[model samples]
Target: MLVPSKIQTMFAAFYVCLVFWCLDSAAGAELAPPRNVTMVTLNTQYTLCWDWDHTGNVTFTTQHIARYKLNSKKKSPIWSTVCKDILDRSCDLTLLNLYYLGIHVLRVRASVNGRHSDWVQKEFSPDKDAALGPPTNVILTPAGSDLEVTIFDPLSSNNSSMKELIPTLAYHIMYWERSVDSQASQTHQTLTSSINIVILPNLKPWTWYCVIVQSRYDYYNKGSNFTSPHCMQTEGATPWWEIFLYFLGSLVTCFLVMFPSVYSSFWCYKTLKATLFPSHQLPMHFKEFFGTSPGSDVPCLLTPESESELLCDNVTVRLEPAILEVHDLPPENLPAPLLGLKPGSSAQHSRHDSSSSGDSGVYSTGGRSNSQQPNTSQPIAGVIDCWNGLDAEQVKMQEMALVLNSRPKIPADEGIVDMCV
Candidate 1:
């Protein structure tokens, strides 16, 4: 009985283990795998994305492996973990540094509450599946009448350039004259696969042009989307023959202007001497009349004897203080002590000769050369001798009288002359 019981107990434990395994399988099957696993690229960046019916804070994990490793028969290929326990369905895969020109495989699965769904994965070729992006930078330049365009290549997350991956890459440029209303024509130009910079020839001078560029891979028959229109102005254009003609015409004009002026200046210089004086020699008699000859000296203004006899006379001028009406004054009114002699005496008369003179007491500064006597003196309006005989009181009275009885006169402010006159 004990041996039978032991066998039945072992069987019952096996059945219980089978039932638990079935239950865990049913729970895993209920959790759905992620859908639409795909890789997206922009510039040099790569991202992994998927779709799922999310519920109750479920998280996701992503992994990737090289497609070539999966194809090898030697050993099991290991999958690289891109993202784990991530709340978002998308995972950034640029950190893996995958090769751009090779095939790759990526997988993603969702997990919730210690339960995990099966992984959903897909194969990807970054070379064939990746799209060619438009040039990262486009530059426009005006080359005289032509417009030049430069296209730069797009970089990839695989540490390479699109041009390196696709060697047949080229450029398609379209440009036209920009209208004021913002309309342009559909003029297209395709460049060689090796060319990145090209010159658009025969553009209008000083006009605006709009340009759009797209990258092309002729071998794959793929092209990137057209870039935004870039507008620039072209420089002025002129033909070589026209410029040469202008230069020649300018030289001719300068010659035509300068030649006449030079000729006129030279002609005037040549005739200036003749216009000022006659060309013929001066007559001999005129030269003699002008006294330019050595023997023709001017006659001396004074003979030798006259030069020795010329005398300078010493003329003395006397200034006498005489009032104008003093001659009619009585001699008894004069104070005799001040002067040397008494009045009315011969000595006084001799001292004051003009007091008794017939010339009305007017004194003289210098006598005439012909005057030989004192009484017969020239009554020059040079000195006033009449005030000499008057006392202080009488002189004061006479000054008042003179100032009252006569009109005031202004003298000239020129050279010195007698003020008494």
Candidate 2:
């Protein structure tokens, strides 16, 4: 193909222009400023800090690390102060008064020309490191049956952006009743308020109360009376359960001391009645026993002769033997007779009687007299023989249809028998 020389030369020039434009754009991109540079006030003397990065071989001076505090209006530049050599760092301002009080606005500008870079205005306060004077705007509120009061730092007004501006306080709340002369006593009533300084005014109910909120740091509130009125009342009196518990304890102690003997006596009586009187049904002699006069049922103790007389029912023996064998008698079989003898009777009787009759082979006399012997104590052989003899006598009496023998034996010396011729 045949190309014109003018066309080739124009093409070559256009290509050179394109290459230069590309190179220039790359250089411009490399020279762009760092983004989001910021300034922070660390304290009263500290004005501002930066959050910035270096680019394209810029020296620290060229990066404009020092922050300048401009005029309040921010129109004029006070001298550009160098805080540090780092591009991302804090700056100390020589103009300390500018940040001493009130809110301060600081702007950090980056300028290599000393003409002051565009100002980055930031608003902040100085570090409150100094000892706080005292609390102000103190308030007292009445909590239920208690007094509560609080004191706030005066500087807390503007530092709302910062945290925890409440002042550290050493305060006490005291109350005193006014005397007749309007004088207050030093020995006043006191209450412990909550730790929080904001809620300090409260008291017990039904009392005329007042509170004095005082701090050791020379803080004062002149407008306050320095003593809050007593607002006091007592909670309800002690509970009924406590009184009941006290009485119940006393009653239990008394019962513990007395109940054992009483219970034991009752138990013994019931056991004796149940054992000795096994017949639950009333006795046939109940009417007679209950109706009889006193002493009618007096217990009787009789001698053997008397018992024999009663048993024999008017049958008189010529001679009543005195010696009675008692060896065969069990202890229980011993009769109630001869018991409870007076000392005089014991001295005269020697507790036994001698017998005139000789000993029978079937029964041995144990040197005991029937007069002194127990009525129930008798030899088994004698008892059995007596029972048989009585049985035979009963048969004879039944045949005779009489209670006595026909001869009825008259006194031997007094009678003479007449013989029939």
Candidate 3:
């Protein structure tokens, strides 16, 4: 119903009224500046905090903003925002550009609907206000008779608070023997960089020790609180007496293990030697009677019957033929004449005996019949032909061979011997 220009002018006046109402509302709702601004170091991070007045009846929708500037006089101070839209009362300083050993000014304020409160400012030095944090990843281990400790600096990272402030770090180590009424010992070591590991030497062996570590900034002269106490034990040194006993036990064990083999080898060697090179000496009485001369003759005693005549008068005849029974003969005894006969001759004699046994009244060389004629014209020798060219050892061996071959084998159940022809 209104004209176009009138309508346009009315809309513009309404817009201006709305704008002024917004400005007045914003001015009335402006937030109060934060108070008691403080900076504190926690672990490896720096935090800024301030107190807010929540006691007023007026309700305000507010947010906090933090900014920092370097405390340099010549350089144009350009403030850098640390954090924005912060509903909490604290802001982390790790997000800011920190300068080492340089002064800084930090400001924080509250904002409500684009209207800002007065900024609360504080001056601080990175070195003076910076606090070192406790060492992390602390470990203790035994190093022979000593103790080895390893730790990592909390401020060694790029985002740490004290990294720029502290040029060098020093460690204070406190240790004591874990016993009643024992005094504690302290050691100090300054390192240009992070101390990754350290060794405490000259410690008591096989002893328990309690230890604690703390770190300090060289420029700030502030030290962190001591870490949790750690307990460790050093390895024991082996005693000389125990080492000697161990050696002796080893030697005894080796001897016990090798003794059986050594003894068995010695016995085997002795047996082989005896078999290969046996003693060849006769008895004392026989030694005197048997001469060593090559051609010397020795009289041998013989057994004969009354009808038997000795061709040599120097030979003695102590045994009677009746006393020399076949059963009484030695197991090694063989026919005396067969020793000089060849295999062919012996076989021929055997065939002749088999063919003319009744008429010839003879037998094989192994034995003779009673009707066989004796060779009285033949001279009796002391030793038989079987032993003529052989030594005593050879003769013994030959006798053993014959005995083994001709020996009678008895059955397990039968006691009587079975003589083999």
Candidate 4:
């Protein structure tokens, strides 16, 4: 049992030394130098950034000294620690109040657990290293064949106003007619800083034009990309040929719209006049009876027959057997379309047909070709008599029923109706 206990103690000592070696190796690997030290400048601001390999929390330290100070052999190179123990990999050094156009060297190192890595260094100049950005959301308006363009400045990655931070920022605008090739188009440019608007004068009216704008900082020699082309049509006075075309189109449209209405109203008026007041000549004998004697100067007021008289137009219907014969023929035997039908074959077959053909209730669409409809002859006798004694008998019957007051009336076969009054 004593030998077994001694072996166990020796094994515990070996395990402790192995753990110490591993911890030391891990510490050495973690304290490696930061990679890719870079200096970035935007306008008057300066930033120092670096890349690191390890994960988890880390702190960085940044130092900068003027390039001229490094070249002086007599002066001691003093690198002030502008950023100390920062969690972020990038550091903003604008607060240090360094000269913007002056060249400077920047260095960064990683720190964890009181251990430091070797410094990684880079050189930067605010005048040459800064990047420029383009204007955004360009707008164009037409001022009577002239175009007015408005430019708005761009924003930084954090959406802050980058133009306000840049004092020397200016804009360059170019415009040309759309009909010409962009490479060969007539264009002009001028630097504008105070105002965001520019005008292009004397463009052709009703013509299209394109515009593009870019921002630049002349002092820093930084220029951004140009914006996308914005094309718009210009407005101006009207041309004579165009006005004539518009007038012609309006005249044709109005005629097409009003023609149907005019024709329909005229047709309605003619039809109504013919139906309400049929035109017929007075009989010659009747005209002579009502006329004054050729030599007399007396008015008809003293005439005996004109004093009290009931005047009515006498009409005589002269329906022929040939018309009846023509009406009774079958549709197939009538005729083909647009050709006249002369009926003679069915004349002797039926006399009963002539008797009933005058009634309106017996009307039919037959007696015409299958390929076409039969024409309805105008100046129709039936339509002329429609408002005459057509409904007189029925109206008289209604009046008689009203007088009876629901009492039973004598049948027509009795030849008499007793009066209530």
For 122-177, candidate 3 gives per-residue lDDT tens digits of 87665578666777757989999998888766653365534445547767777766
Best by TM-score: 1
lDDT of 4: 0.66
Off by over 4 Å in 4: 1-30, 73-75, 136-141, 150-198, 217-221, 228-232, 238-421
Worst 10 residues of 4 by lDDT: 342-351
- Of the two candidates 2 and 3, the one with more favorable lDDT, higher being better, is 3
**Which candidate do you rate higher for lDDT, 2 or 4?**
4
Please give the range of 10 consecutive residues that has the lowest summed lDDT in model 2: 399-408
Model 3 TM-score, 2 decimals? 0.42
Clashes of 4: 0
User: What TM-score goes with each of the models?
Assistant: 0.48, 0.26, 0.42, 0.40
lDDT score, candidate 3, position 411: 30
RMSD of 4: 29.8
Q: Candidate 3: global Cα-lDDT?
A: 0.61
Name the candidate that leads on lDDT.
1
lDDT of 1 by residue, 283-315 (tens): 766656666555766433466898888877998
Q: What lDDT does each candidate get?
A: 0.69, 0.42, 0.61, 0.66
User: Where in model 3 is the C-alpha error above 4 Å?
Assistant: 1-31, 42-44, 55-78, 113-115, 157-165, 180-196, 239-421
Order the candidates by TM-score, highest first: 1, 3, 4, 2
